[model samples]
Target: MRKSFIYALLVGIMVAWGLNVTALKILVDHFAPVTLTALRIFTAGVVVLLFLWGSGQLRKVSWNEAKQIGVAALFSVVAHHFFLSVGLTRTTAANAGLILGLVPLVTSLLAMMFLRHRLTVFRLLGIASGFCGVVFVVANGDGGLGHLSVGDVYVFLAVLAQGISFIMIKKATVEARVMTGWMLVFGSVWLFVLSLVLEPGGVSSLKDGTPSLWMIFLASAVVATALGHMFYNQAVQHLGPAESAVFINLNPLFSLLGAYWFLDETITLGQLVGFLFIVAGVVLGSGGLDDMSARFRRAKVAAGGRKVGM
Candidate 1:
């Protein structure tokens, strides 16, 4: 596929994912967080599995791959979704979205530690900037060094779990779609177990859901969770982790806009500042800045060669 197409796809995925944060807030307001997450993830998993089977892309995994998928699901799907769901219940979607902008920086740091990716001076600065941004968001938009919001804390944990899962994903040899399907399936099982324990009447709560609510839930599951992850996994497979992570910077912007439009949430000045810092950090820490510079130099050299030839 062309780079342009892949870039466009990534942007679309970010938009879906960003708006899904608001969708999640809507769901949690109506249902138990863990229970809702379990249902949504399981539904999305079934959709992905059906797609794979229909497309003749479904294949059996080796024992080791299954183990990897199990671990990845634990972190990525189960933990990340659980925390994100609960977090959204307590915090504004705008805050959750901005906090999640830390994902690329966290992923880059994890890569440095586990994958032996170099921690350049720029990356260090970027990491510092990213944390500062999170602080502003987590401090309830006062930009003060005050007590942190518990919801923001959960969202940060979600980021950490997701970052670790990215490392596991990078090491997996399975097809991206197949891996994503299995991960969702496995994670859904765990989430269901958690819901059973934490939300005793949660499943029953869904019985009272309005048709509109169900519509939102289905859209979140099918479009945002299932298709979004499938496209993202494909992008990571094609582009590698760092390049794919760069696209995540767009996620917060979309989320902020979605929150404003869908939830009527106000965008605070601190959040705007946090967004700027986080985007800068993502670019620097994820090596996006370096990549841009290299591309520019290559283009410059090409243009100079053309001039000499003429």
Candidate 2:
């Protein structure tokens, strides 16, 4: 796919993800975190399965692939959503979006350690800057780092879990589309169990939930989880992970805008600073800035060569 079109598509996907966070904040107000998580997972799983079947790509997983999918479910779907939903209840959606933006940095570190990918000095510095941004938010005495809320900790851990899952999935034999479906199915089961044990009334909350809540639930599941992941996986396949990941840096901006527009949330100065640092870190760490510069240089050289020949 053309780079411009890919970036534009990614922008749309990230915007959906950002808006989903705002919707999540609203959902938590009406539904218990685990209950919401379970419902979304169930909805997403069903959608993904239908898509796979429609595309003639659905197939039964091997035993080994099932095991890998189960493991991925634990880290990616179950743990990530459990903590993220809980965290959204405690923190602003804007904050959660910015913190989650650290995902690429976390994923890179995990890739370096587990997949034996080499880390350059630029990447290490970028990683450190990203951490500093996290600390800036987490350590803010008024709910930042020094006085970390349980919510902040949970969200951070969710990021870690998701990062680890990214590495684990790379080792799995199942195709991304199939793997996503299975992960949602397995994770939904675990989430349902957790909901029953922990969330009072569990699935019964849906009975009492507002129509708006259910609408948001469908949007979150269908738009953000099912379609967003499908679009993202396709982008990764076409552009490779590094280029595909560059769009993630825009997530915080999209989230902040959505939060302000939908939730009337205000952006703090500290949050703005943290956003810059995190975005810069992501660009440097992911080599996105370097990649663009190289492309520009090549384009310039090509134009110069053409002019000279003419």
Candidate 3:
């Protein structure tokens, strides 16, 4: 029963995050990217605070923790979202979703570089395939392999920033709930200030926006940010990080389907091929094959032992 519940929760998380890309794509059409990001982060931060306070988990963040959180916030939330927002404006959500699927591959490379993790042959192949997939996608979708679109570059940069934050997050000691809330707070402040300077009159544009615009904003803030994070964190607690992480790969699939359904985005042959490569690379890079081998060995030994006992 517990296992079933966790699996269901995992699916929910995947759906929330998957549709999140689609929501952002829609929201960007109604609001400026930075401005939209700022509003979403701010609203989510308030929800986090309220939840923490209600649960008696709210506490003063120490200076050291605050500094760590700040560093993570800068890359993970601020830069990641900034680039993602800008990139989405220039590219289709389907393209963005497929490109972002390389996060695991990038994170693996970063882990090897910063944490002294071993780089295996499988991972190397994974990296190569992932890059080739990106190149193919760019060449077919944008223009040529050599002439990458600005949006693609921005999305790649967003992935890089997110990868760095994934590394930095390992060094932090704060509780996940507290850290995430603070990260949202810091990200909100950073982007809000940025929006003010770079996107003047963006906030006021909301007043004239349609009901669908407000609905997307509310959904992005409440469903995607607040509930998604909460459910994901809960799943991590119940399922452990490794098992929970496998579900994250479903995020791109959701985004791809959602984009097709809502935005009427078409997935071409090249994009589909690229998507396959990226998913395979991510799985291989994350040691799915090694894990399967280990599990098979265990199962074989267990079966052999049982036969002998019989």
lDDT (tens digit, per residue) of candidate 2 on 211-291:
777788899999999989988999999998888898899888888888899999887778888888888888888766657
* lDDT per residue as tens, model 3, 130-249: 887887678777666776788888889999998898888777898887788889889989998999998998888677778888888888888888878877877877876556767777
In model 1, pairs of residues that clash are none
CA error at residue 253 for candidate 2, angstroms: 0.9
Clashes of 1: 0
lDDT of each: 0.89, 0.87, 0.85
How much is the lDDT of residue 286 in candidate 1? 86
RMSD of 1: 2.5
Best by lDDT: 1
| Predicted structure 2, TM vs. truth | 0.92
Each model's TM-score, in the order given?
A: 0.92, 0.92, 0.92
Worst 10 residues of 3 by lDDT: 284-293
lDDT of 1 by residue, 1-310 (tens): 8889999999999999899998999999999899989989999999999999998999899999999999999999999999999988878899999988888899989999999988787889899989888876766543345766778889989999999998898888877789889999899999999999999999999988999999999999999999998888788778876688889999999999999998999887888888998888888888777677779999999999999999
Model 3 local distance difference test score: 0.85
- Candidate 3 ranges beyond 4 A from true positions: 295-310
Off by over 4 Å in 2: 140-144, 289-310
